[model samples]
Target: MATFCQFAFFIAFGSLVSVHADMKLDCQQDFVSLVWTETRPQVDTSQYRLGNCFPTSVTATQAIFKVELNACKFRKLVTGDLLQYSNNLTYVSSELELLPFSLPVTCVYQRPKDWYPMIYNPVFDTYGQGELLFHIGIMNNDFTGPAESSSFPLGSLIPIMASVQQASHQPLQLFIEECVAATTPQLSPNGDKYTIITNKGCLVDSKVSRSRFIPRQKSSEILGFLQAFRFSTGEQVYVHCTLVAWDPVGLDKTKKACNYVQGHGWELVDNPSYNSLCDCCESSCNARKIRSTPLGNEMVHEVVLGPIMISEFSDSLF
Candidate 1:
């Protein structure tokens, strides 16, 4: 009886070992089902065939994303086994939308040897009491791209001037003088006029008050001035003192005025006549004449004004 019982015990132990081995082999050869889950509570099940020697379980590298293998059934799944999957991707934050505005005025000054482009910044200053002078400058040689015309506020020319003064490195004196001495006027084909007037005429007075006169103050004059220049979007034109004198308040005009003028067919100057100042008339000055190039397409419209001086003595005084 004892021998028979021992034999039965051995047989039972062998059977148990065989079953364990079979289960391990099956697990290694079986296809795994992967389940993907998200915070939204939706889950997707996919099947993936595992390597014959794959381990029973494994941990995922990312905490937010997890991979699971389902090995409950041996049937070939239509969607295949759910393989390693992740659903814990981070969502990106939304950005605020901004409105588009017209491009800013681009100013280019070209000498015979080199050229420099700058963005025009309109500035204002209060000498005392209610006295104000609107000063605009090309603060830097930043020629990244075309500037937004709306970047400077039309009604805030004085404020823009003040802002420029505040941001200047030097202590801006309330009594500043204009630089360019001569400007010549030109008429646009579409009837929009503009002139480049030098500060030579303006510097005659000791304390010339500078203010941006709106069209309402002088409508016909302003209209006449604007009608003189031809503005092109892609062509580069020289912004001489002539144009500045014609429309010193160009910086103060409304968007409607600019758009209207532009729509009227103001185009870029291709072969701009530089004889307005007669500076290029001299044989030595021929080297300094403005030339048109393929890059002229980058030229932009800008209004620049300066202090007044006598035209005859502009070369010396300015």
Candidate 2:
């Protein structure tokens, strides 16, 4: 469902002239839509825009604009646990002597509380010869959901959580060395694949899409979001990821969650101060010898998730 917002247009310059423009803002979980209506003074629909983005559809009296939440030059901010993105809409008369009117628009997403592996299905959990218990599952937009097969809208964000149950083992850190999506439940070497994560923890998909890794909440857990996509039209998708367990405090260039920023290159998500460790993301990350300790040997597991349907409409699996 869309949240409708109504804002009155105030004159920024020139005479008031009884000009009234009714603006409707549709703020959704993954995108924003806007409709600008001019009922009074006649105006050119082409002059209206949202942050340099023109209307996707326009008419004599109304101009409609639609944009994804992550695009359109929106300003992003992280305040505590809340994520905020904002932009402006403007209308400028085509007449030679007229001033432009602008309106501010914003969208905020807050993380849900106490969401974890307990709510997930035990079927998706994989045990590593009783030494480690690993679980991989899908999540709702707010990060709460059952760890079962789900459906997501194409081009939307898919929340995924990977965790390790340490039972009586030593403290550990979890890293996703690679993630690949295919049409079948089992990933084959020669099958068509879409790489979402590679180069150890580098999120290569983020370079072209909105896919990213969320901040770490626990040493044994790693959460991230993959932008919904498809390998074949309307075919169910499955994700296979290689999970590795390492020493919590022994992070190096080869073991890190790095995201590629347009201008800043690769950045370390877990700890920015350790950004130097992500410098190797642009190229190949060298392999390190396994340590002789329980946590150092790095328990590795390959986990599969999905049968997720990517559809035209939006829906959560929770």
Candidate 3:
């Protein structure tokens, strides 16, 4: 065993974090991660992402920790997190569940190949926490080359589906970005109609997996499958195939972008409300339709093949 040294880290907000027995405060590593293989105590890690990749795999260390309590018999997972702050030592953690036993967190550290400078400074240190961050799979953006995006005229309904996964194989409607307390969707006998809309804007579509009494063993594919929605009432839309981590608990939905501040403090920053506004990275190539006239007032039937737009799937999706 590597002989460990104990150190106290002081937070500006009158707090101290003693290094955990299994954790080391080091900065020279190329990569550092916290992981485990326990299945029951974890929630959908496939859709879970931070920065550019999912952490639980061989390349990343981010994991979605979930715990089940015997008292109430409920499932919960954390959502919003500021993985790193201004320094190599600062890290943020949300509440998680791992029934019968506490979550086994293993920290792995490696030297970096090439990364931007890191510091830990907060803009508003009073909140004791920074902004909320959402993530998706890294493969969604790993390659380059104009991927297809679809465009749609006004009054078009686009197909949308959200998969709240619990593991690599289990499928459920419980999506966790920041585990506060999430309510399950009320469904009919066959899981057909939802009483308490899980994902708003999407109407009830046909179920692809099993019936209500038994959902598809918690898979990663589809969480809440619904058909189509229109973001705006006016103006045509251009959208790309995107994945998003939706945080239901947010002070301001617009402020979802994450950026590092000074030292050990990464702050949740906001994209400027002008030019190209960036929401959570759902539509990878989500470009806003700026001040432009509708295409010549003549309705064109030809579907232009360019990028994956929400409008392209305005009809069918597999």
Tens digits of per-residue lDDT for model 3, 32-55: 333322232233334333323334
Q: Which ten residues in a row have the lowest lDDT in candidate 1?
A: 1-10
Name the regions of candidate 3 deviating beyond 4 angstroms. Answer: 1-35, 38-318
User: What overall lDDT, based on C-alpha atoms, would model 2 receive against the true structure?
Assistant: 0.70
User: Best to worst by lDDT, what's the order?
Assistant: 2, 3, 1
- Residue 285 deviation, candidate 3, in Å? 27
TM per model? 0.15, 0.56, 0.19
User: Model 2, 106-164: lDDT tens per residue?
Assistant: 66555334322243332221212236888998876645566444877777788899999
CA lDDT scores, all candidates in order? 0.19, 0.70, 0.24
Write candidate 1's Cα lDDT for 1-318 as tens digits: 011100000011112112311111101111222221222111111111122122233223111211132332111101011111111111121322311111111111112222112321212111111212233432211222222331221111211121112221111112111222223333245543232222321221112222221221111112111111122322222233211211111211111111111222221111112113222211121222222322131211233432111111112211
lDDT of 3: 0.24
